[model samples]
Target chain A: MIEVKNLSKTFTSHVKEPGLKGSIKSLFSRELVTKDALKPVNLNIEQGEIVGLIGANGAGKTTLIKILAGIVHPTAGEAKILGYTPWERANEYRRQMALIMGQKNQVWWDLPALDSFILLKEIYQIPDAQYKYNIEFLAEILMVKDQLKTQVRKLSLGERMKIELMAALLHNPKVIFLDEPTIGLDISAQKAVRGFLRQYQKEFKPMTILTSHYMEDIKELCPRIVIIKSGEFVYDGSLSDVQKMMGDEKVLSVTTQNGVFKVSVPRQDLAKKTHELFEEHYVLDLNIQDPSIEDVIESIMKNGIGAT
Target chain B: MKWWKDVMGMELRKILAYRSDFWITFLGQTFIQLMVARALWQAIFETQGVSEMQGFTLEMMGLYYLIAPIGMKILNGPNFGFLAQEIYDGTFTRYLLYPLSVFQYKTLTYLTYSLFYSLQMIILLGIYRLFISEVAFTSVDVGHLFLGLLLFIIGAIAYCMMGMMIEMIALWADNIWSLAVMLRFFTSFFGGALIPITFLPVWAQNILVWTPFPYLLSLPIRTIMGLSTFQEVTQGALILMLWTLIFMEGVKLVWKKGQFKYTGVGI
Candidate 1:
């Protein structure tokens, strides 16, 4: 459903230092710093598969998603979604795909979610019967049937995010691009979103690509994972592969009296490890051997990775 | 036909949802436009009583002044919106990524607000014409008025497209509001919203006459107020059509290029 070959996006940013002199100098002679938000990246996704993009803060997850969704053009390389070039963004290509961002809302703030949905239904040119049916099914599954009439600003974050999902799914898109779709919500809200997405994917079997820092979100939605650091992709495989490879380490802290702690590593295990020795016997130690996805990310960032 | 129905129906629902804001903006727009029109009419009389320039008797002059500005509220009202802010805030990406054209989205939204605002302004203009417009068109040729309204709508669309073209610059610039203000200032002054073009220095009017800004608001008023002969009106509409075509072409080019520049930072 989607193919991206060596796609890359670079942004030119102006760097101005603070201080009166620096500001004055910039006014006359501005300096630019080219930032590679996304290095040359490649990927492909088949129908009914969920792919997760994981990375550090400056990683290129959002940039890659934007390029694939046809919101931002890449500096180089080729990308096609649903057999049409994404950057060209033909109407046919747009109709089959939906992009959802959890942090930012697509629903109108002051108006009820129903109003935005009505507007989108016409814009998408959905037939009346199909539109009504889709909204009804989505509203029921997402538990937002009553909240549709409430003003968007009045809803809780979880409520608003559910409505956003409903808006994105109203047209029954065949491919979905989700960026941090479960961010800033309680665990229950996050679980609800994940459940709805899983059901949507199962029913429609659309090619789904998701990006999220929350490891649990990825584990819940996507079986395969792609990890990028500092713009270049470093890892791509199943979720278990990541935990076995880069994250083959465990966190062990023994809470003792007076908050004193010690590591429970056998003398035979690798002796070399960065162990944080607290003044108290609570020696917090870090080692390399099977860790969670979060710890792996921290290790990758900490270890000054050369390049991919 | 289906496309038009979908576009208009969507717009209607949006207006209904924001009914309160619609009434507030309409009332404010009518009061402000009328006040400006009244002041201009008084100034014209104070300077040259019963001036015949542009076929205005003192009464026709006052009514012309009144109609032109109220006509302005109808034409340019839809032209102002948050196209630029949406781009800067990354909210516009949702629309772009959807199965819709930016042209269709903007044009539909503009039509909705235009329908709501124009209805109110037309009613207010009717009441004002009854009491304050010293002389009215005795016949009130509905066909001419309809044609004038049609031209006005075309002009509004073209003008709003031009605004979108300028707003597209927000993809690159951090702050685009100043550029928007500058665009508005020139369009308002050159478009004859403040005063009739006939009173301007001949050379100044001659320079602006060729520009599209005048067609945006003034040409429709001219068509209805009978400021031009049939031959001149036909020629002017042709020029307006040319401007609209050029603006439409510009919108396509700018929007296509502007998408490349959008960072999608927030989205």
Candidate 2:
């Protein structure tokens, strides 16, 4: 449903040195530095696949998504979504896709969400029957039925996010780009959003590309994960493969007679066996076994010191 | 039809939802315009007799100021703030994702606000005309007034389009406030809010005559004041139509070309 090829975006910024005199000198004779937001990134998203784009701040995940969403013009390469050149922004192309940024609210602030949806319905030219059905479906799933008539500003954050989601999906777009769509929400709301997205994707079979800071969202919702760092694609495949890329550093956080004892081991099986009953301390206490993603990521960042 | 109806409906919904604000702003803006007209009348009466200024009689002057709010409703509605906002916040992408063009969106939104506010202006004008003795209603001028209104709507829509075109400069320009201030100042100055454009210097008046700014408010007022002939009204309408087309192209080109350089920052 979406194809991006050799896509790259570079931004030029004026380089100025420190101090007032240096700044004054640089103001007249400034140097230009080209910062690559995305470098030769290529990807193909088939219909109905939930792909998670993962990276830290300034990691180019959002940049790549914006390029695909037709918001940012790429400096080089090409992209196609739903039989249309995204950058062209044809009406037919627009009718087939939606982009939802979590930190951003799309609802008209002074008006009810329902009113905004109605305007969108007319703008998108959705059939009345289909519009009603989709609204009803999204309303029930997002649990925003009661709040639909309330002004967007009066609604809670979760309710507002649901409305934003409803507005994006109102036309049942064939492709969806979610940029940190679960950011700043409570855990329950986040899980609810993930569940709703999972169900929506299953039902609609849309091509979904989601970028998020929460690795759990990517781990649970996306089968395939793409990792980016400093404008380059580092890993592209399943979630565990990304974990394996950090090496077999099975982290075991043991809570025993001591408060906490964390071990960096090579194998999970051996760690679990040791934690079972085979090995015991003099005053054995609580035994905890978990190799969280944070430890793996920290290891990766530590290893990627000079690479950046 | 589909486009206009949707935009119209959006405007209607907005008025209904904020009916309190609708009434307050409507009255406040009308009163402000009325006072400005009254002050201008006092200044003219001090110099001249009970007769008209230029070709505008005292009664016609009252009527001209009375109905200028109708033009104001269409021309000076505050929708350009949203354009500046969308450009700054990067939510403009959602606009691009719509089947409607950005031009269509702005046009529809402007039309909506005009229709919604026109009703309020008409009601206020009706009340003043019925109750106030000084409020003019040369009664038999309905046909000309109606014709005048038809021309005014075109001028107002054209001016709003130009406003959007100017506001879109916020996407690239460092000083959006200056652009907005310039637009407001020019629209009122050339469109004849301070004085009837006929009274301005002939050279300045001739230049204003060629542009669409005067037609936004000045032409309709002149028509109401009986200072212009039917041929002049028709000519004014044609100039407005021409300017509307020009601003439409301006909007199209600015929006299309501007989106390319749009960084979509702050998302």
Clashing residue pairs for model 2: none
Off by over 4 Å in 2: A13-33, A252-290, A301-308, B1-3, B47-51, B79-82
Residues B1-267, candidate 1: write the lDDT tens digits.
355565576566656657777676656665666666667676867787655656556566555665665566555545444588888777887777766677777776676655565566457657766776626564345556666666677766766777788888887775689888888778767887666777778999889877887777677776666554567566667887787788788888887677778877676
- Give a tens-digit lDDT track for model 2, residues B22-51: 666778777777877877787778787656
RMSD of each candidate? 3.6, 4.3
| C-alpha DockQ for predicted model 1 | 0.58
Off by over 4 Å in 1: A127-129, A246-250, A254-267, A270-290, A304-308, B1-3, B16-20, B36-61, B134-140
Give one digit per residue, the lDDT tens place, for model 2 in A1-308. Answer: 78888999997767788899888998579787989999998898899898988777897988887887777789999888877878777888888889898888777887888888888887888899999999999999998889988999998888888999999999999989999988899999999999999899889999999988888788789988787778887767776665555464455555655566666665656547555533665334444444566555544434542321
Candidate 2, A149: how far from true, in Å? 1.6
The most accurate candidate by DockQ is 1
TM-score of each: 0.89, 0.88
